[model samples]
Target: MDTVITVTGEQSANDLGVTLPHEHLIIDASIWVPDGPELTAIQRRKLEESVSMENLWWLAAYGRQPKWNSLDNRRLDDVETAKREAMRFVAEGGETLVDVTPMSPGLGRDPGALKRIANHTGLNVVAGTGHYVRHAHPPRIDDQSASEIADEMVGDIVDGIDGTGVRAGVIGEIGATNGFSDHPNEKTVFRAAAIAQQRTGAPITIHPPVHYKEGHDVLDVLEEAGANLTNVILGHLDGAMELDNASAYYDSLAERGVSLEFDTFGRIGYIASEDVCFPLDETRIRELRRLFDKGYGDQLLVSHDICKKNQLTKYAGHGYDYILRDIVPRLRRREFSETEITSLLVDNPARALTIEE
Candidate 1:
């Protein structure tokens, strides 16, 4: 509650410069990989070939396929590659990035890796605790009680991760699946996350389902568990534009006092619903302005939810610097004053991520 826990060491929230509140420097997720011993060459080629333009569109509109999963593209294992990307973000006026890589196995369970990135690139980093989505968690999570899960999450925040003595500053990127359904495992984790938040005072960032109803359902679970709604950040709202009643939906959330994280700036291609017909950035900006118009400016945050290799510069995706390089200027041109921009980029992050304990 007193200081923001950075990978380097504890520091004042005032020192956390323009921050990307909901992003990941290294997210090695094997969530969607089809289980197999090994693929034959033809099978491997077929799997690789399955990732076509149409396939991505299908993924955006429909759901995951048995043959077509983003397995190979889900890893950011090269620390040097991540370091190069972090420096790019820092150089372009970004000071800190809260990496929501959780303690889930096969993902970002190693706090040492985050510490290494911060120590090398001199970028302030904050790691996360708890499991991610249901599919991302290990099988053991299903058998654990809520208190048990919360204890482990607290350990990740207070003790360390992977026995490296590097603590997590946040409790999530805790996840809910389509429609934010109260899947037993997801509900259990949500309850555990709320208890962890109440105990540790670290902010909770939720990876919400894209459906409009799912957002509110997630809040319901968090609130029922007595989590402080102010510190509860509902992420992935940029893609929520696919909803027809996006305005009213976001308004309701903002009024409930949760932070609205428009964390996917240049990530329009990664749609999940069939309704995204507008230009990506334009739709995002419009939706953002609606939130502001509804008097939710102070509770807003933005970032690039970069989780794939193609999302890096070398792989033809917009690098980590894209938000600063392209989006900020566009906001200025769209008549958002410097003061308004500062509130979203600077002030909101400091306040939202700061524990209320």
Candidate 2:
């Protein structure tokens, strides 16, 4: 039987109930933080303070401004806080959470911490193995060949991550930006992921660029590198649905047999901080219906992708239970059957994450 590897150990796929396929329990994503002279003294001080009710609105409005907001929101390193946030999902009947924090410098990927969280919460924590985008890549990456990188990833899957004895079950959210041509180091990591996937039978999930068209470029590199398209996932697709031909674009991506992960479930409204305006839940429901109507329900995955401090319940955001507490009921109202919801939350993740025997 195929088994799903967890930080604790191997688990039967049937037992992986009501899974959230993408999440981060412990992470430090400060690589995205910008240090520039554009900030005034007060703005810089505000940036240092933790996110709270008083400054939450300002942070949401200008968090990505680099010069205007706080950098504390870009980090999630407290294990106790992570444990508390994870339990919120557990209370809502969620079982498995795939923490896709890649093994890149400054982006905390801790298998020991993951194992501890699993032990405490009784949640199946599946860790990932891969490099992130260009900025997160280590300085030694220049000296390593693609095969050498793949070897490290393979070791993480087959043996353990950094001698922690906690094997990774998945191979991403390996990151890519712009297009395939623009970032050679990202491409190298992609190729390494493809190699590691073939060797270990682990699934690959990619963080593609914002442009929906550029997703195809990422697929091209993975496809050419001999990765299994069926086990590949393209994440953050919700952020790329603004163009006129988005529906058709999604259809084309579905046709390629890769799982399209719409992981930003609860992040609604305009994120002026980043100049990004995510579609409302109503719009996302329509898109799901569109994909379902086109016979691509099986090629879909969903999650909250809660990576920032403002996204947690402690900061008054929706927290990890948003999908179960809010979105699932909306799907029912929209006429999505129980079987369809099961396929999305249970069956798809089980199939995508199981390591072939």
lDDT of 2: 0.87
| Each prediction's TM-score versus the true structure | 0.90, 0.96
**Error of model 2, residue 101, in angstroms:** 0.5
Predicted model with the maximum TM-score? 2
Per-residue C-alpha lDDT of model 1 across residues 1-357, encoded as one tens digit per residue: 457877777878888889999888887765655656564564445445433454454334332333444565666777888889899998898888899988788785556778888988777898888878888888998689999999999998888876888888888999888855648899989999999999999999998874444788888888999999999989988667766777788888888999998887776553232435323887888777777877889998988888876677866678888988998899998888888899888899998888666
Candidate 2 lDDT over 192-276, as tens digits, reads 9999988989999898885445888888889899998898989989887765788888999999999988988876665555555
Model 1 residue 354 distance off true place after TM-score fit, in angstroms? 0.8
Segments in model 2 whose C-alpha atoms lie over 4 Å from true places: 64-67, 271-276
**Model 1, C-alpha of 252: deviation from truth (Å):** 0.5
Candidate 2 at 261: error in angstroms?
0.5
For each of the candidates, the C-alpha root-mean-square deviation to the true structure, in angstroms, is: 3.7, 1.6
